[model samples]
Target: MEAVEEVAAPQVRQCPECGTEVTVHVRYVSWCAACDWNVDPGAPDPDRGRLAQVRRRLARRYGEQLAEEVARGGSAAGRVGADRSTVLAFGLALLVHGVTAGLFLAAAVLIIGGWHTGIQPVLGGLLLVAVAVLLPRPGRLPQGAPLLYRADAPGLFGLVDEVGAAVGTAGVHAVVVDASANAGVRTYGFRGRRVMFLGLGLWEILTPQERVALLGHELGHFANGDVRSSFVTHGALRTLGAWHSFLVPASRGNLMDWLLNTLLFLPRWAVYGLIHVLDGLTMRASQRAEYLADAGAARAGSAGAAVALLDRLLISEGVEAHLRRESVTAARAGGGSGGREAREAAERELWERLAARIGSVPESEYERLRRVSARRGHSVDDTHPPTHLRRRCLASADPRPARVVCDGPRARSIAAELAPARAALARQVIRDHAG
Candidate 1:
């Protein structure tokens, strides 16, 4: 009997049910083995000049993105603020407070032992603890990651890819929608590179063009690493600041002890004031980061888009609805059914109120624009800067299409503009790293 020719186990057209790749005879039904992700392998219909423009932009900008490379060392792990670092800072602060306490206790012992000299040292140590506890500790820093999307329209994602490539950074990894109706980056995790919370309010309220621009703005954050740095900074401060509450009272008690526990209890108001100052600084830093990210997005061939997104976001009720919906959804997900329902009802009421306001638009050009916008499924209420102000800024900037080219000169200019920020961040990185 002739041995039957062995066939290679009837090689399937799809990947092994456990692998990530596969041999596909047709492009339409490719499947992944790793996680059961069946994908359409057919080439995407050609994007009418969009991908080409992105390629051109990337080609034009790649060389000038040297500054991004410099920033990579600090942001490389794609993790923003290290929670361990934060914990350490808090621990050190605690140790300092402990030492201060020990010194005071020793002073008391000495006082009882008739040795007066230790009293001043004890008071000084107590003062040091007071300062440590009263000063605002640093907060978590921001980390940047490539924007990734599983739910956005392909067109939108394609545009984001273009912008990301042009800006000379890794592409985005997640879609971060800040349901807070606030146009800002929302961060979590030690390496703040988790999600790009694009406010759903922006999506529910802006024109397609405006939505595109808002996405461009977020891409701006990715390119700049502002998101990551911001997270790290905030985390660092918060961690340190938390130690203050623990130390302030103990130090106060020590002072009271020195005064025979009768001089006066220093109100906790001073500690509160310190925290406020720290929060203000963090806010200011965040604002600056926003501006820079906006600028970067504008440079990525979508100044008008960014402008439109900002404008619509400022005046869209859809943003409010989106926020309310997210809150309800989150509440429900967290098992708070009754609370979620109440919030959803409240959101519906707010939407009705906003509709009434828009209905008041007189029969004029603004009304026509409103109708056109409605037809386009766009909203005007957003969470960031006001529309009028954003429009004015874009107008004053006079950003032309030609300027969007990430050419050598443009890159150099961007790098130069970012140098100071980068330097400051480098210092921070060093400090954090050393710590």
Candidate 2:
């Protein structure tokens, strides 16, 4: 089996655009020694749902506008202060909470009336159900979620705390590990405590300093006054999203079901509209939060490391693709009965294979990804601005020394702590992705 074809090149061809002799790396469409061609593999996930489509459209719209403004101006990290959206978001949140309170009150009144009149308290029960449906989902760790506490991973937690201090933010309350090629932070629990999620896939690929930068970025994400991260408005958004999801049917059903669905169409659409409006109202502010986080990354990890971290993000898709290919290869190697053994073998070598693939990314490929990033609306996700823009913001900023350092010994200690997780994640990727 070929090990990540993009990592190794043995083919050379003339450029279709310039007729210049070029080495054709399987990573991208084609490469020319003298000219750029259609290197852009636009929008990786195209077949998204209607709601997702709306979110992506809005993301690109806002991201492009912001990127354009930044290109003309100096930095993308412009401070957003007391923006209209923040006020509106807070008001909307209050309104949502008010509605919930009213429903509960109505339920109470009906229940009392039923007790006096000896009536069936059906309406009260129904109102209570509605209140339950509309309640906000507090961020909680999913059952069986992989956890890395300070006790189990003190060095990692210490590094994160240092980065948090450097970025001028409070330390996280919890750390969760997953297999995704991304990292993020969010508030959890009743008191809105914070948790930092680190994806081992991304973590393994990053340099020690880059990890510090990632932590800095995540730690600073909400501290820079992102209203979306505010637990108050967060409840509103979550409740509305839940309402929409609960009302919207995945498909049409039987006659009576269809009739009820038709009756609910307007209410369902209203909830959806609210969700969209909420997203639109806060998207620019959310993106601003991201740029601010990038600024904090530079502050905590040094400008160079922060910029390199963004550059590393450009190739994350490639890493995912490599995983998919490796999984398929592993599954197929066993054919029928031997698939399990083959997958186990693949699992054992997963980290090494991934490390080599990431290490082998050519400079030209990074440039291509960067260019593609610039051409597309700057976004790694709906809320994130583009990788190119983030990179530019970091690179163009005034240089600064790292506020926290991850020396060799500490790096080794952190790695040792993550060993079990890494091993489990390797099996997870193969098991989940193999076809």
Candidate 3:
């Protein structure tokens, strides 16, 4: 008897909206390129609130404009001068600073001039407390991450220094390692000393060259000197946050309390408006700065590597989820009272396991990430432009060869330097997740 023939279903399907033929993947969203159907599969976060919604709208609008401009003519769109928005942003920041200064002067007068009046001291003390709350705190290095100096990790520092030079900036003064699925650079303390934070989760998954791309993008922030990161703007934002917290009226209790809150309504919302407008202005500049940084990424790590870096970032959510699962598994496997053995075993296979998962990602998955990113206007945050635009900008730019190359010896040396930090971080992860 002849056996019945079996047929496998095709991966292609029709879009419900446009009826256009589209290919579906088991692990990725299937979308119609022509109609953009299913391009945005994720739902919005209801808890993100109104302020977040406004910021995302601004990011999407400006990001699309910049993307088009970059596509048409590369550098000119990126060279947007301090426009009206920038001016307003700075003015608003200065106003915030001026308020802090005004508070100080008022407190001094009340305390010094009214020495004969007993109540003046009490009022002055309250004002001084207000001053302290409103004062702009400088950036601080993270306490959790282990620090590394140039001497301790010469190979890593040297590579960063090279990337910095390529991007036309001095390298970081110190390096700190963390277990996050991200990397960043920031000023440390009042002196504005530069420090770079390397996240092991993302770093472990990157090839040597992609790591260069990561460095390039971060150092590029320094070279470009994005307005939002400046002390003036950042300080203003922080101060605004403080003001918001301080002004939040207590819940209704009494008529006098209600009356007091009624009086504060204007001031409270006035600060709120400043926060929104200030963010609007600086966020635009920050997005533009991102394009400039992408250029630096291309120059330092090659256009291809830069694009690949963005693609890698697209899948970082998945990477984070995988890490959480791995953490739980590791905790369970440790099998001891404190799961000490589990921590050790997880650390032993941590990187290898992560690398294997990332390496096995199919091409279709990357494509899906790009599409979803485009539709949802995905970015690292409001400080960054959309990832799709970043990719497009890199693709449109003239192809560039890598300025800093990571060789086998240096890579090994750097890994060796990171060993202790990695182990400590692994143990910490297990401890946090262990049941």
Q: Which candidate is the best by TM-score?
A: 3
As a TM-score, model 2 comes out at 0.87
- Winner by lDDT: 3
lDDT of each: 0.43, 0.79, 0.83
- Winner of 2 and 3 under TM-score: 3
Candidate 2 Cα errors over 4 Å, as ranges:
1-12, 26-28, 41-61, 64-80, 249-259, 328-345
* Cα lDDT of model 1 by residue, 112-227, tens digit: 56445766656665655654554333333335422325443343345556666665555444554323354544444445443555543334344444544565566666655442
- Better by lDDT, candidate 2 or 1: 2
Candidate number that wins on lDDT, 2 or 3? 3
Clashing pairs in 3: 334-342
How far is each candidate from the true structure, as Cα RMSD in Å?
A: 23.5, 3.5, 5.5
Candidate 1 lDDT at 90 equals 42
The 10 consecutive residues of candidate 3 with the worst lDDT sum are 1-10
In model 1, where do residues sit more than 4 Å from their true spots?
1-157, 176-183, 186-192, 225-231, 240-267, 280-284, 317-389, 402-435
Q: Which of the predicted structures, 1 or 2, would earn the higher TM-score when compared with the native?
A: 2
